[model samples]
Target: MFKSFNIRKKIYYLSDTIKRKNVSNHLKEINFILNNPESNKSKIIQKSNLNNILNHATNTTPFYKKFRNFDSILDFPVIKKLVIQDNFNEFQSYPHKDKNNFKVSTSGSTGVPFFLFQDEVKRNRNKADVLHFLKRSNYEVGHRLFYLGVRLNQKFSLKSLIQNVSLIDISKLTDKAIEDFLEKVAKDKNSNKILLGHVSAFETILKYLDRKNKDITNIKLNSIITNSEHLSVETKTKLENYFNTPALSRYSSEEAGIIAHQTIDSPDTFVVNHASYYIEVLNLNNNTPVKPGEIGRIVLTDLFNYAMPLIRYDTGDIAKTKVCDNGSIQFESVEGRKMDLVYDTQGNVLSSYVFNKIIYKHYKKIKQYQFIQQDKKEYEIKLNLQEDKFPFEKELISEVKEDFGKDANVNITYVNEIPPLASGKRRKVINNYNKNNSLINPALSKHESIT
Candidate 1:
């Protein structure tokens, strides 16, 4: 009657063992935090990890050595990606050791690149964190994943075979390729499959299906996770409608791994990766913690990344957040990048969601789009249409003028296809004018609507 050694658990343990990554303890610790988030054990583990990392970072690295006297994360300065670039060598754990250490890099949506050194413990913990989040999204240890990517030239490998991950390249997603992929999943109806990739790739698939009037209600996917780009609420509904399954948004980054994930029941609020990251939502102007439900900068203290030891690293992301009594961090919504934030003609602050609204309103006509604010009153829109005829060009211009200003110079250009960035993400909003990271607008109030 005591069935502790299940097949799934056996596979999980054996797989980790095969890789020589003893992540059982790490995974257990993560589960403990998730289940007993408000428990004393959870608080102690979080606090201890924070203190240990700070202590380790200060003791080992020259960069953090100055902050050695300061124990709390709040005492340290919140650093940006640029700060890491300037002090790359100083951040690494010195003494010319740690053979298990490795390097990782990311050229994010803004085309800005940053790198980090990760130790074996941090790598294993990241693996465990990803697994923990995926498990919450109906993913088991054995389910095959239909991965979407861009410009990735993948080949046959032992890991791919063992993991059952069919990496489909989205650099050029042909209709035939999509149909065949859907057929493969539908072919194995009982075996629950998973789909994970960029939000844009999923949109392309949906657009194709809609164009062809195809039905794929029999795919029987365990979960559909859109990541690597902003996953809008409207698009999530469309994906779920067609796939007939729970479509969730996975908010992750190259810097930290899985940050937060939306649950099936709570689609708006994301369940934070409390297992690995001690998250803080701070105001834009002031680097202090923001109140729950208020939008702020997502600064993370990586409890697991001991190699580089990132203390109070500003993630360059904005989000409305909530912290439950049990020490769980939930994001109401992960808004777009801090730089991608747009503005009105007179330089009034605008919610990035305004662009999403325009895209949603014109989904039927526009295949792909990019909004660029060139000058204070000059705006440009590049559109790849679903069809040749766009009869509402003037209406679109008028609508944009309403936001940018009635006398604003707004131009619209039709394109064959809006090309994805080098990072494979289609940046929907780009403010080329300036970077006003401050939440306060001296022109008027802190924020203003399109009206």
Candidate 2:
């Protein structure tokens, strides 16, 4: 039966199964920890693993050698993206055995691209962790997955061609593009399909479908998983309404594989993958654990990445934490990356999510967008577009004027590309108003005149 389907996909699935089995022991240990949340044995195992990784990093990795005398984990310095970027080579444990390691690059969304290597074992473990979480959504090994995210520029190998996966580049999303992708998915009647992609990408597709009045009721999906950005209630509800399936959100990064996943029982709350990662919610002012319910910076310690162990790695996102009745820790809500709110003429603070939804809703030709708040009432909109001109620019401006009032000054500029931050992360909205404000204000109306 498998042979009748795509042979390359079948072969890839079989090979993936074998690789997953290779890390069966690690999976079993993780499962054990998940099952026995109250058991001291899990903590003992976790501590042992952390100690082993730390010992290895201290002895072999040049970056961590200075911390050999660190008696407590807290005493160890919290490393940021720049630290890794500056000392790339020092992070590797066995640089001479490059054959045993695979190179992985960060998305550079923060404007700093980080290149790191992972041993084959750590890579397999990451895959295993992903598989375990997928099972929560009733996803099986043979299920067909439609991934909508960043498109890799590399040529697809025979293995990739055979895999039960379809890719749609999120950067090129438009009304016609989304319609064609959905039409293709609608053809596969018997396959159990799963939709996975960045949250914003999913929102873009949903908006396009809504505008075109496309019906997706006949195209049944097992689940919809969103990642890469903060998943808003509005977005999740929209997805669930359109697809008629549970829309789950996942918190993960290129640097650290699966961090947390929304469970079937609670689609809104994220349960941490405590076995693979030790998560900490620290005070933004001082790097110490914040009390439960207080929003703080999310720091993570990867238990399995021996090639480049990330201890107390600040993830640059903020979230409140809670201890459930089962003694498990969960994220109450993710506030997204720390960004200043854009202000209107009346001093009304507008969330970045609000602008994101509005821009994508009004303009179908926009491939990418960024909003820079020049002042309280002045703003600049930078766009990377799929077409030469935005047909709905007038309507979009009207809508913005309605929300922001007529006193607002808006400038729209089309660009070939919007650069990511030094940390390799792209911010949708940037607030420069407060940063530019000084004690002695300029007497010239305190605002730049817009032509």
Top-scoring candidate (lDDT): 1
**Best-fitting candidate, scored by TM-score:** 1
Scored against the true structure, residue 87 in model 1 reaches a CA lDDT of 84
lDDT per residue for candidate 1 within 1-451, as digits (tens), equals 1122244456667888897897877889998997677788988998888888888889999888987888467667777788788888888878534566878888756656778888888888888887777788887665677888876759887566555667888877788877877787789533757899988888888888888899787677888988888888889899989988888988888878888888665566898877788888877656666888787878888987777888778787889887766566689889968777778977776767786776577886788999988778888889998789888889888888877689889999889977777778888888877653443422222221101
Tell me the deviation in Å of residue 321 in model 1: 1.2
State residue 171's C-alpha deviation in candidate 1, in Å: 1.4
**Model 1 bad stretches (over 4 Å):** 1-12, 18-20, 95-98, 323-327, 435-451
Q: What TM-score would every model get versus the actual structure? A: 0.91, 0.78
- Pairs with steric clashes in candidate 1: none
User: Tens-digit lDDT track for model 2 on 249-331?
Assistant: 88887778888889677688887888888788876556667898887778888877888887778776677888889888888
Each candidate: what lDDT? 0.78, 0.73
Q: Each candidate: how many clashes? A: 0, 19
